[model samples]
Target: MSVVMADEAKDVHTEQLAACVRYVPPEDLKVVAQTYDGAPVMSGSVRGVQAHFREKHPQAVYVHCYAPDLNLVLCHTCKAIPEASDFFNLLENLFVSQCVYSQHDQFASIQEELHIEQRELVQISNTRWSCQLSSVNALMKNFPAVMKSLQKIRTPTALALHSKLSKLPVVYLFVVFKKLLGITEGFHKVLQKENVDLAQVVHYKSAVHDTLVSQGTAQVAEEIYAKAKAACRENNIHESSLGPRRKQKMGDFVVEVSCGSRSDLLNDSEHLKQRLFYPCINRMTSELENHFPNVEKEVMIGIQACLPASETFLCMQSLEKLASQYNIQLVPEEVMVTKSFLSRKGTEAISDILSVFKPLNPMMFPSLKTILQVTLTIPDSSCERSFSSLC
Candidate 1:
């Protein structure tokens, strides 16, 4: 699709089409290929073919084309020169045969990878569903004995089972959950002969919820755009800005995103401006550091991010406090809200955050602190205790 490649293709094709020499059947070659002295019959026969194609088909190459392959051109006298048309026929057939053979070799590999991926999906579903099926089978065996008191076992337990069934991917799990839980929940209607209109109402309510959710995103999207427009106007800021230059230091970093369509998702352009931060579980950054020293670096930890608008400031303060308690250095930065060539995006805030937390993280470890404490415990405990008593 590139211009260079297109030009090359045209050049190659034009050259090949122009160079296409005439081919005659073996019986007709007497008048074409040679005269009495076994030389070409006409003086201009060889070079004239190039001139003929250039004049007639000046726009594109068409010589040595393959009608059988549904392709316009496969070979031409400019590149893959053939002594005769019969020679080209043989070569084209061989090429197709080799192509089919290569495809056959690759077919098995493609199928094998697909099979492995499919098996992983199947195994994941099967193991998770096995527990559900076993429980259902046990429930079926107790059905007749508990027919009178089925209402007792059905309500609370069935609702709980229904909640769990929602997570399962299998359709049969949903069917079984419905059937067994119905046998438990629907016992009142079956035994006492009351109306099931209330149950139908619940189904209608569920349908309404799903319908609202399906349309919720589009409705919210309209309001979001209106809010953005209002905010842009209220700040008393121009649509365009001309700010001064930013000054940064070593180790200062920012994530650059060319927000083509996602510009609206960016609430602020600052270095560390808190957005909709989701809480995630934080774990150890390392493991074997306890035994040797550095093996714990491989561990991944989960951390909570502040969200809900009001909590952004609280989370920032908590982050600073947490860093200080552990002697971790942190650098926090502000948000960039203007279209300026020179403004550094909240650099000062980010720098302050990073500085506060940088020292705390490494020193927070219990083992490191214990090691330091033991080392400073002193060689003479008796003299140290006596000196402390005097004090």
Candidate 2:
């Protein structure tokens, strides 16, 4: 629970971690879990801090912090397409070079003239996906002002940014990412909650996964393309036609052509969806699955079933498995009686449930209380928030 300056070496980390644990009172020094970002010094599978700590405390399981992992999922997904990556890079440059401190009056004046709500452009954070949604929303809300400001400036940076911003693909990407990030914004907030538990995290993660999958379909892509097209028209930005298809050649001889004429070519909307929308959506969905696979593990399932908010709350099979795994003696009749009492409280938070038992004797419901404690000990975004504040 104490923060101290130290080297990045695994040995140093291990020593510092041990010291922190030792600082706790002997009676309360039960280490059930450890959570950290996916840093090599902290999370490396072998000979890392977590590994060394596990050697000493076998009961303390390691959990990768979800907030940063979610950010990684977004970063990897954006990088899957060259166009999407460039668009975000451009967004950062625009914020750094133009919008943040300098030209505030210019942007404000433009916003007033355009009747747009005055809002500052948000700087994107590399390790925070939640901030990206804010940045994108701010830019989208003040799109006309930004473009107008860019137009009035003659500097090389502003001119280059204006040229890129006017393009059809950039506009399409803006709309697409806004929609995609919007879908995950709620889940991101949930992850940041101080009292969030595994059951809530799993529920929101599944919802985000399903929503992203739906976004990848052709119908949704078409709707997004239409929105982008309308934005381009509203801004008076020239909508360029799709470029020529790359000719497949064999030793400089044309083997085949994708289209014989303009009539055979795909429309701009269809082309954008096929080339950009589908690929981006598919990559994001895949990355979400890859980064969060452990949520479906048997141990996690059992833990979820024990939570009051879970759909399978009070499930006997899950409770028995959890008890057996933890070596806790569970009296089924006592649990059923407790369940009837808890059921009357409706779906209360884990903290609320813990408070309900604070006045009761520990021996009355040891298994349930242990499971709840373990669930709360598993980290969420609080660790990341602390690191952010320190940095």
Candidate 3:
């Protein structure tokens, strides 16, 4: 466990890391990987730390924290839709103020009166998007009690907030985000699993975005709008249908929706669908694709090729690159010989082979053994697990 005190200076991060590494003697230390938060690793002074450390420890792989990356993706994607952004802000106030701290007793009293379990709202965090899921669940679970509490309160603030919460848009947004976050919450949890590797993380990222894109399809969009309208009807909440029609300007030609002949209520629902559901899904899919690029896929594919058991494993170019990365100078013939040997005898499971590598003679296959140790010893979800313990 290492504690790094962050400062603005670029050298400060590198100095602290070097100081820590100094504590452990040169001959005794073998750093396999370094996992850190994405922001500092990508844009902050930690870049210097990584560069300096890699100069001394060439085998160390730097991995961005998976959990924080996913959280950041969600936060950025949420900002693309006005409803989602507002939903989170409103939910933050409702959860943090009403259910968690300020008026928690009032909220609990209402829940008690309604004969429901007393549950507190989860507080939102700027850096952790998963907390939003807990907040949404708390809201949906105790919604009835929340409404009753607001209605019974005589204060102006409560009444104003109640007025907003009682509206069809607010309630509909609540339900929609609850459903959306429910899906995202699962993805978030999967990324934080101790056993999850970069390959699995990349797979989950692709699957999640693909699912979001599928949800934005026309048929699915209509189904979602229908559900929202049905919920509105069931609740007897009258939502406006006549509003500003969506417009598109193309090369001095103005194109706008002519809602003149259409039913106002239907047009309104369509507007709501366009504003809330479809855009949210599209934005999430786009943001995820943008944040988690195909380079990760390429990197994972390259790493998999280093596995001895893989039939499609390491080529000459890949072997050279891997060797260069770990500061292992390999002759072309050595790589070819290793590849030939593995092709003939690498049928054994990778884990079983790796377990025997250390005890076996390293001098027998120096290049193969060195590469295997580096690739196999790479940590998975270490950053998230470490952060969890700290919290």
Which candidate ranks first by TM-score, i.e. highest?
2
Give me the displacement of residue 43 in model 2, in angstroms: 1.4
| CA lDDT, candidate 2, residue 133 | 86
* lDDT tens readout by residue for model 3, 26-127: 122567556554444532434666556667765555654566666766688667665577668777766645743546777788888879898877777765
Off by over 4 Å in 2: 1-27, 99-102, 245-267, 293-296, 347-361
TM-score of each: 0.14, 0.82, 0.68
In terms of TM-score, which candidate is stronger, 1 or 3?
Answer: 3
Model 1 RMSD vs true structure: 40.4
Poorly placed runs, candidate 3 (over 4 Å): 1-32, 39-47, 57-61, 99-106, 112-117, 245-267, 293-298, 304-324, 327-372, 380-391
Models ranked on lDDT: 2, 3, 1
Ranking by TM-score: 2, 3, 1
lDDT of 2 at 272: 82
lDDT of 1 by residue, 127-184 (tens): 1223223334432332222221222234554334333222211112223232322322
Candidate 2's TM-score: 0.82
Q: Pick the candidate with the highest lDDT.
A: 2
Model 2 alpha-carbon miss at residue 13, Å: 19
